[model samples]
Target: MSKATTSKARILAAATAIAVEHGPKQLTLDNVAKKCGLSKGGLMHHFSSKEALLKSMTENMLHKLEEHGELLKTRHSDALTITNVIRTKKFINEIIGMNEAKILLVAAIENRELLSSVKAAMLEQKEAIMSEPKSEMATLLMLAADGLAFQELLGISPFDENERNQIGDKLIDMAIALEGDLHE
Candidate 1:
């Protein structure tokens, strides 16, 4: 990547780490700069303010999700179907392990306006899923994924690794059955 692109990415990554580690209220340009080993002036060159940084992070999260959705289209041939949603391994990993969701949650609480684009993107995805032939199944699969994500984000998930895997396998089986029914 270009130097500017690398710098911007490092800034965003540092900002996200700060948000996840210290909470959004503690995230500041100075902290991000210190974490990124950049001077505050350099950080400002990439992100003028904390809000700008958070906004960019949120946009990056949305872009990554869209990319994953496209990959699902190639893998499953029906991106909006329950099968594709259930088989979202990359998204599942991100939802469970990455700080992007936590950053967005903190940003939304701190400044609702920052999430307007995120909300719009989510609404667009929902509309597409609602138009699918197996809309109910798609909704169910999405809800299950969201529930797991929320539980993980809040550190309240009760499932151990084996249990979580069992649950995921069961859901995949259900999705496969749904796909079969659709084909028939």
Candidate 2:
């Protein structure tokens, strides 16, 4: 990787951990720089401001989501199945727990305006889901994914991995049945 990219990754990693562990209020330039082994100037070189850092973190999640969507299209030959959606949802849940999602929440509290772009992208994704033939069911499935992810994020999710997988399978079965009816 290029030097700038490498540096940015390390910096963001440190920042994310700080935000999650100590709260976003503690994610200061000095803290990030110290944690990531960069000077304040170095961190600032990549992200000029705290808002810029937050924006990059938000962009990172959106980029990954977009990339995952492309992979879904390619894997299913441009047909994103309910099965694929459920699987992706599972993966997304993991990401939300482990990564920039904490920072996104921080950003929400720190600056709501930083999320306008994410809002637009998510609306586009929602529109795509809504455009499916089994619109209501598909929307429900999508919303369920969000619900599942949020519950986990909030430490309130009750399902173990096995249970979660079972639930996914059930969702896929129901979705496929709805889709089949749409075709009939």
Candidate 3:
């Protein structure tokens, strides 16, 4: 990566750590700069304000999932609906058992406006699934994934790790099976 990319990543990493450890209220450019060993000016060079930083953090999560979605799209060719399921699975994986993800989620919840990118991504996935013949099944899968995220995001997980994994695997299997139905 270029220097700026590396520096911005470092800044984000430090910011997340601070937020996770001390809460979002404790996150600040000066604090992040100190944590990342960058000057305040250097940090500002990437993120001008807290809103910009929060926006980047939320988009970063979606970008990782989208990157995987791109590869899936190339392989499956016509499995657009299944891609949404896979993206949901990836998103759930990103948040489950991840401190940084948990923190970022909480931060996003606190700043609802920062969640627009995530909402947009969800809308896109919903649109794709709704266009499918087996849309109800696909919608159910998406809802399951969203419910899983909320369970973790709210610290109200009702299932053990094994059970949750089983559910996730089953949902992906169901989504994959829908591919043949789409062409029928």
Candidate 4:
């Protein structure tokens, strides 16, 4: 990567780490700069303000989700299969573990306006799902995935890894059965 790109990535990493560690309220350009081993001026060159940095972080996360959705679309032509639902859960789990999802949650709590882009993206996803042949099934799967992620994001998930995996397997089986019924 080029110097600017590297620096921006580092800055974002620092910001995300700080948000996860200290909460979004503690995230500041100076702290990010220090974590990135850059001067405040250097950080400013990349992110002009705290709002800008947070906005960038949110956008970056949404972009990742969009990319994952695209990959799912390619992998599952139906776009609402049991395998795809499981994959969505797995993707959300990965994001939660990475602390990126925490950043978005924190950002939303800190400033609702910061999540405008995310809301828009979700709306688009909803519309796409609604247009699918199995719209109800797709919506249900999406809601389940979101619920799992939300529980993790809120640190309220009662299921351990094994239990969670078991639950996921059950959900996948149900989805497959539902899909079978749809074609019958």
lDDT of 2 by residue, 1-184 (tens): 9999999989888888898889878989899999999899989999999999989988887787777756765665323355466656666655464455666688898899999988997687677767767777788887887677676565577987677767766776776677668658
Better of 1 and 3 by lDDT: 1
Q: Which 10 residues in a row give candidate 1 its minimum summed lDDT?
A: 89-98
Better of 1 and 4 by TM-score: 1
Enumerate residue pairs that collide in model 2: none
Runs with alpha carbons beyond 4 Å of true place in candidate 2: 77-85, 94-98
- Cα shift from native, residue 4, model 2 (Å): 1.1
Clash total of candidate 1:
0
Residue 93 CA displacement from its true place in model 3, Å: 1.1
Q: After TM-score superposition, what is the CA distance of residue 92 in candidate 2 from its true location, in Å?
A: 3.2
Clashes of 2: 0
Task: Show where candidate 1 strays beyond 4 Å.
Answer: 89-96
- Over 1-184, each residue of candidate 3 has an lDDT whose tens digit, in order, gives 9999998888888887887788777888889989999888888889998888888877876776677666656655556575455654554474545564665565565688888887888798889888878888778878887787668656689987778777777777777778767677
lDDT of 1 by residue, 54-111 (tens): 8999998778777786787786664345666656643556454656788778787879
For model 3, give the 10-residue run with minimal summed lDDT.
88-97
The lDDT per prediction is 0.77, 0.76, 0.74, 0.77
Candidate 4 per-residue C-alpha lDDT over 18-107 given as tens digits, one digit per residue, 9 for 90 to 100 = 999988777988888899899999999999988888899999887776677668768665425444646765765655674888877777
Note the residue pairs that clash in candidate 4: none
- Cα error, residue 176 of model 3, in Å, equals 2.3
